[model samples]
Target: MQDQNSAVTLADAFNQATYIIGGHGSRKVKVLQEALEQVDGETFSDHYGNGSIIDEFQQEMAEVLGKEAAVFFPSGTMAQQIALRIWCDRADVKRVAYHPLAHLEIHEEDGLKELHHIESILLGEANRLITLEDVKSMKQEVACLLLELPQREIGGQLPAYEELESISAYCREHGIKLHLDGARLFEITPYYEKTPAEICRLFDSVYISFYKGIGGIAGAILAGDSDMMQESRVWKRRHGGDLIGLYPYILSSRYYYNERIGKMGRYYEQAKELASLFNACHGIRTIPERPVSNMFHVHFALAASEVEPLLVHMAQEYSTAITSYLNKTGGNSCSFEMSTGDRYDLVPQDKLRDALTWLDGEMKKKRF
Candidate 1:
């Protein structure tokens, strides 16, 4: 087995592979250049979030989300924090509920607690989706309930449509505002067989990321009723989220969102196909076994130390990179997340098949 430090070397080699089977594409300068290629600098302008470019995009997103209004934020962290604050203030409660692994709970370094002074009530176990039973059994009152569609941490799994509706109805009956942490909202539409607006209507407010599935530079849209939007505008300014000119992020968001929103179903199908290939291997399996969105987690019954060298060899010899790194998940097991996108379609089928065949044979050898 390779030393612990060898994972870094393997990752570096993986990045240099001719083909990578994840994400929209490489994050090179050309990505920005391509997004702005047709955008005319002179025609669009915004000052502190109040111009045609920003206004029109906000309106379009509001319509898409079935909300009365939408406000663009520099980051989903800021937007979601402010959203919970608004709900808490309205209900005169300082607590919000969400999955144990919601982005704000795990990734934000307690910004929601420190910046917004809002307490979080973790809803479900760390390893599974939050069920309607979890919401019904909340021991304390919370001003808002947040649900992340296709929970990212647990292999992009989603609750069934009926379960979601039941949760939404219960929240409404209890006067608890439901907000969607829909950073990858567009990516899950194919599985639910519902439009974005249909899903957004279940929640009181919805937040969508432009960078995640849309492949934008960076930005998010917070959509809700007119009253909530007006309040959010105030909070956005207070948080310094309103920039003098956000045309770069705005234009790229609009460009890529329009370009890729219709292709979510294609990405979804690609994800299932790829996950099946991974599952066919001797000791590898995807988290959900079947994807509910464009993304899923791949687990190997071998330690990171055992997998890194093999992945490096695959990249070097097959010119196809499956993943760059793995996270050790206790004794003799490791995992990594995969999200299908434009690059998945770009990989040569014959090369991908041969690479996986080699991987399966090697994994069997290691296990035995």
Candidate 2:
């Protein structure tokens, strides 16, 4: 019987939840919602099935990514798979080269194999990057190359720009097309000191995610030259990504990008500050000496049992949130991905240091 407006949310109980994955959605989403509610406003009028809005978005993204054209998809998985399939069709080859931890190689559930019938040649070690020299040693003529910007599973590490340029340049000389899985690209831009369009200029096809940085409900955009994307649209439908309603995605994306853009730099700053606070702690070390962006991983030792429950209990007590994934060491490591949320606004580096220190103390107290 209560009004819908009075509904409660998960945020009402937990105040300090550190959003390692899905942070707050963007700010620009509200404006779009407001516009949609207007009396004469046409929210899905033209763009529902076949519309110019998609074309407009594609063209703008192509220009921003410095490609000839672009195609929007309901998911990055479809965008990336179709992009590779297109390359295979164009090159008349079926093999791809990529880092071992690349999303397509590990996370896409073998879509390239099942859906596209393409194979992958893992380019490097589980813990390291795939370099130009790795490409030089390839045994087969791959149809394409896949590169993930700021490789996430390995902790958001990126190869040096010089190395990235060399790898792409080598692909060009060898008649191999390069495709970029630029899902977390905007976060990587500050490190490279380059624009998204500039980073994408070297590749034949680029896929950017709307959910990761832009905070959309869910969507992805694939950009390339006109002919390629014109072809990708057909593939998009064949692959079942042509959703009937895209208003929620577009609206949320538009809003989040505008609102959260200001906070990204602060995330990077606070990550560095937090890294400093964890200095010289026992059994604790950052994956990389320095966090490349707003995201980083903390590798620490604790009793296997203490790892998960301790985090959950502390989270509940402090009204905070965090996620920890187990490791080969039988210990636990946690990640901090500072995206969106006022939860972290009042949480200082010292507080995080205190938490880490508490975890260590708890482990010792239990004699584990």
Candidate 3:
């Protein structure tokens, strides 16, 4: 149990720590200044997501994702739901196939079903990546398939490149549309050794989140052929996603994408290095053994109660914040996810290894 006196916020823990599992550190003033500097004379957009930075950003994203057009949404939830709805409507089949843990199925609170009237058929086991065999096994008629690259819920697992191609081929042969839930698309390209466009080519529509790997203030892009995106714009307005002015989020997304997009390969390498360090420790291990992307899970042999205090203590003493808390998966094991980015980049490898060693020792001592 954590003492009231020792309580630390996740935000403060992030700021105090020289390293973190996800994202770079930013001061409020610095973030504000960066956003302001990125903007030119014109700041705001005209009515309903038009004529300014929003259109410019959307155009840039469309090019980046290799699509004829792109539409911006305030959230990925709105963007993705609309994308799936489009596919189902086109095929006249109200079902989509995706992993059981895909965001659309678990995280969206049934919005796809209740709001869009689309049914989801979950694919594959909870602990495994979706395979071509699993796709072949689904007997239901699905209008589209949604693939979440790097499968964030299960320690950022991803399908093999050849296997991904096979699954997409199967979808195409069957006349089913493919939509990619590429919220962290930028982070996964390093593993596949492919460009975002190359991977995106396999899908009918791709949705990218601005805030996740790109570190935007907040926004999402749904990109596809012009006809599909044109229809999406209407859905965006209907869903209340078309804002009067979205330049702040657009400008922030543009600035961060430019700054961080080039570094994702390095982040993927760092994740491998960090995972190796964790696996080398006696009492800790990284899930998937080798990281396929910029994220992985660190499992400790300690209970949740025991691990929480250690995290709090680490924050107070070593100025290292591993995570805010640990989740007990089952039995005596607890796991927390680590995502390498600029925060981890700021700290030396030797220093981070030392922190891992100390954490290992604490977990061992507590277990005995």
Candidate 4:
């Protein structure tokens, strides 16, 4: 147990908070200010649907991905559901193959099952990035296949490009439509010297989240051939994603994608350096030797439940904010996510120790 009195925040110790995970928020507020200027409309307006920022956003995304078209959906869930539903509808099949931990599977509260009326065949192992081997190994008759790049369950581990090629080749040979759940696709580019468009070309359709890596307020775009993406716009309307006005998300996404898109490399480099710091600690180990993108898991001696609140409190009290976390499973280990911000050795360890030592003193109170 961490002694309640022993932890300290960044403010108290070094006047800086340590962020270990999550996208860099608000680096360019000017971009947001630029968007808000023309955002006068209803919360989710859709009556006129004339030049909705959503359309503009989609057009920009389409160009970025080198696709014929793109459709903006309020949520990745809707975007992805539409992709699978369309694939199933086209193939006249009702099944989709995906990793068990894919967001569509584990998250979403079974929305795909209840709403899409499609069955999902979970085709990968637990806590591992599914490889081409995993894909080839599956015996499934399905309408389409979904793969989450940088598998979230495994701290953003991505399969090699060769593996991606092999899996997509197999799918192509079988006439299976491939849909990529590219929620964090930006991160994958660094691992492989490929552009987003190049990698996305493998899949028939690709869904990218505006909020995750790009740091937008919230939105998603599904990109594919002109006809497919145009058809998706219809599905988007059916699923209530065709909002009359989605200017805030549109503006934010434009700002993020334009200004913050290329920072993934910097973030990943920081994660590697931070990983070294965590590994140097007495009771810390990385979930994977190398992080696939800007994220990785750090196992600790403390329970995540206990560590999380304290980390927050310490950050608040002293100024070190721990951005992401993983509570352990069946063990005393907790996995902490460290972003590049903390990895920068700006604050000396001795100075941080004062706050941490203070936290140690304070955490003792929680024990009782």
What lDDT is reached at residue 189 by model 2?
74
lDDT of each: 0.92, 0.69, 0.83, 0.72
Query: All candidates: CA RMSD in angstroms?
Result: 1.9, 6.1, 2.4, 5.1
Writing each residue's lDDT as its tens digit, candidate 3 over 1-368 gives 23444567544665677556555765365774677784666555646877856777888998889998998889999999999998999889999989999998788899998999898898888888889988899899999989999899898988888998998999999998889999999999989999999999998899999777777778899999999999998999998888887776777788889999999999999889888988887668888789999898988876676667677666656666777657888777799888888887777666666676777777667764
Clashes of each: 0, 5, 1, 36
Give the total clashing residue pairs for model 1.
Answer: 0
Superior by TM-score: candidate 1 or candidate 4: 1
TM-scores, each model vs. reference = 0.97, 0.84, 0.93, 0.82
Candidate 4, 118-191: lDDT as tens digits: 99988878777777777777687898989888787777778878888999999999888899999988877887
> Candidate 1, which ten residues in sequence have the lowest lDDT sum?
1-10
Off by over 4 Å in 2: 1-22, 25-41, 45-49, 324-343, 346-350, 363-368
| Best prediction by lDDT | 1
Evaluated with TM-score, which candidate comes out highest? 1
Better of 1 and 3 by lDDT: 1
- Residue 186, candidate 1: Cα error in Å is 0.5
Clashing pairs in 2: 16-320, 17-321, 26-256, 28-255, 29-255
Q: lDDT by residue for model 2 over 182-278, one digit each (tens)?
A: 9877777766878888899888899988767555567788998889888887887788777666655555555556566566666566656655544
- Which ranking of candidates, highest lDDT first? 1, 3, 4, 2
Q: How many pairs in model 3 have backbone atoms within 3 A of each other, for residues 3 or more apart or on separate chains, i.e. clashes?
A: 1
